[model samples]
Target chain A: MISILKNWVRGSNKLERFWLLSKIEYKLRYYENKLGLVWALIKPLSEIFIYYIAFEVIMKAGIPHFVSYLFIALVLWNFFVESSLGTIQILATKKYLYEYTNMNKIEIYLSVIGSNLIGLFFNILMFFVYYIFIEKGMYVSWHIIFLIPIVLNLVILSLGFSLILSNLYIIAKDIQQIWLIIIGLGFWISPILYKLDTFRAALPGLEYINPISNIIINARNVVLYNHVPEWGLLFWGLIYSVFFLLIGLYLLNRLGSKAAEKL
Target chain B: MELNKEKVAVIARNISKTFYISEDSYNTVKKRLFNLFNTPKPKEVAALKMMNFQIDRGECFGLIGRNGSGKSTLARVLAGVYPTDTGYVKINGSTMLMNLGVGMSHELTARENIYVSGSVLGLKIKEIDKVFDKIVDFAELREFIDTKIKFFSSGMIARLGFSIAVNAGAEIMFLDEILTVGDIKFQEKAIKVFEKSWIDGKTVILVSHSMDVIKKYCQRVAYLKNGVLEYLGDAETAVNMYIAENK
Candidate 1:
């Protein structure tokens, strides 16, 4: 424990390095494009618009504040997809960072998640803007502070999944293709466009089985529905994510030694 | 010369690394399923055989061998980049490896590369800010500081990388052919830096084919031949052994 504290003091420099690298990574993504950072808002807004048209206009789900409801789900889910999927090949792609310098492996994973997080922050801000001015949902309340832990949960979950996938990728390149299919199927299963209650009613065990489903339900309840979050589901979601993270870190420690040599 | 704990900068004990390369790599579920009953045995390549060595603090050590001789592997193992398969390596201080600038992102500008590499080497932003101009000036990339390094020539890239290492280097540096690139003028400048200012009190493990460099800078040299430590003694004997084996 004392060693960890000592490391924290020594690690101030590492944290700074992590922030700088992540910022550069965030900038480099849109460095060549003329639209630049506007793309961050454009990509998600277009997705939301398409879903808005399909579910609300065509299907007429008749859920009040449907746009805000869908917005919260998509923003959180997209962060999971983008962060976890982006880091699958991180061991090979970011080999230079650890291979050449005395960088801790955790920092490499943090930087990838960090860049995606910058995008998530922007989308969350846009969600608030739409909620206040455009959608004008009458649900804003003190419960909004709950978004902090919710976002932290998402970040940890994504970081955990990425750690597992990136290390596994060194062994089998097919994990990428396999994960793509899983994520595609995962989107529809996770109550993104539809109401969580409808999903739980239909699937019955989705709230317990799918962490994303729980997150979306709780997030919408707090933000869109103006109700207290489902604490039991929220706790379950945290447990699932932390569990995945621990397993992922263990896999990395075991398989990550071959990273520099293989990649 | 009495060998003591205080004088040692690096120590390797019975270290070995073996890599298993698949004959026909199967990374997907379908291929794995098809081959489940008939899995092909992987071919093993022992990159480093049982090796033991100790490097003293402030000493310049030379590693010389032919291609695939495990010089690079030993350097990496010693640098803690690759894990040793059987034994362990202990390093006293932080380490940085330079091989034609491995960490510089081509997407970033030279200025950004300095910050990235400097930060990775454990320099604070303020410390990097102080030495930023020196890195640019030494590399003679003042004009192309903001230009993406992908546009820069290989020589310019190498110069930029070497300059960063010179300015914001770790205590222990593993130089893997950093001097082989760049033009004659830059090479001369690099040699001057090594001679006058660089190797004064730093631990350097230089991996190069140039016997002249090995003879000049290294007080002791390790000659590896096919993953085996063939010689570890005075630079003159190792250089002669390497030259004789080349014939």
Candidate 2:
């Protein structure tokens, strides 16, 4: 546990490094585009619009505030997808540091996640703005306080999966292709466009097992529905989060030093 | 005169390293499983032999060898960049490896690279900020500090890399062919900084094919002949051994 937070006490310089690198990464990602930072919001907004047109207009979905609902889910899912995929490929792009310098291995992944967090922050803030003013469903409730821990827990969980994927990616170059397929399947598996209750009502036991579905449900209850998240489910989510985090830490410790040599 | 062994800055013992250079092994699960039942083809290239050496604090050590003689590998192993296959390396203080473009991103500005590169060398961002001006001044790229590095010339990049590594406050420095980079003026400026580091008593492990540099900068030198430590004593003997073997 201390090992995870050890970067902090080791110095805030690492935190600054993460921030600086993440900023450059975030900028480099979109600086080439003519649209600049507007491209960041354009991705999820267009995604939300397309989903709205598909399920709401064509299928005539009965859910109220469907655009807002889809926006929240799409934004969060985009973060997850970008983060995991970014984590997998990040080492190859940033291998210069390890090959040429003495950088710690975990710093690469942390910066990847940090870049995603920058994007996610804007997306979440936009959702809240659309929720409180333009949309009628959510108010600034005390339940929103739980959004902090909820998102953090999900980030940890996603990082765990990414850590495992990154190590695997080093050995297997085509892991990204396989991971892309898994992520595509994962989108429909998680409760994003459809309501979480539909999943719970349709398949009672499976929702409890899928951590992705659980995070979406818990997040929706606090941010979208403004209902208290299920504590029992969150407790399980926390357990899985911790479990994946431990796995990631172990793999990174083992494979990190060897990463440069293997490359 | 013998240096104080108790104040050793780096100790490398029987360090051996091999690279799995064979491309026959499957990288994917499907491919790996298809060939699982078959006997695996194994091939390895030994980069370093069972080399043992120790550098006391304040020693300027040079490694000289022909191309692919594992001089860079030995320097990297000593810097803890590559792990030894069969032995251990112990470094007593903060270390930096000085290579071409070292750890800076070309997409970033010189100012931007300073912060991240400094942090990569284990310096705090605040500490980096304090030396930021000094780095730019040392690099002689004051006019181009905010300019994106991709726009800079090769000489400018080398200057920036040298400035950061020298100012990173690492006690032990591993330099690999970095002295050969850039123009004559930049090299002269870098040698001045290096002379200062020597006076300040920093431990330096310099790997260069230039005999004049090894003779001028190194008090003691080691010559590696195909990953074997052929000579490890005075600079003159090592340089002579290197010249005799190469010719």
Best by lDDT: 1
Q: How much is the lDDT of residue A148 in candidate 1? A: 80
Model 1 CA deviation exceeding 4 Å by range:
A1-7, A10-12, B1-6
Minimum summed lDDT over a 10-residue window in model 2 chain A is located at A7-16
Tens digit of lDDT per residue, candidate 2, span A1-263?
A: 88868966675566767887788788888776899878997888888888888888999877887887788778778888887876786666787667765567788878878878888898888888788889864577788888887898779887888888888777788889998898888888778888656866887777667677777777878877678988988888889888988988887777757787765
- The sequence of per-residue lDDT tens digits that candidate 2 reaches over residues B121-207 is 777777888999999998899998889999998888988888888777467888888776678987887778778865367888888
Kindly list the per-residue Cα lDDT of model 1 for residues A24-139, writing each as its tens digit. Answer: 98998865699999988888889989988998899998877887888888899988998888889888877878898656788888987889989888899999998888875364
Question: What is the C-alpha local distance difference test score of each model?
Answer: 0.86, 0.80
Q: Report the TM-score of chain B alone for all candidates.
A: 0.93, 0.90
Predicted structure 1: lDDT: 0.86
lDDT over C-alpha atoms for residue B201 of model 1: 75
- Cα deviation at B29, candidate 1, in Å, is 3.3
Model 1: which residue pairs collide?
none
Candidate number of the best DockQ: 1
Question: How many collisions between residues are there in candidate 2?
Answer: 0
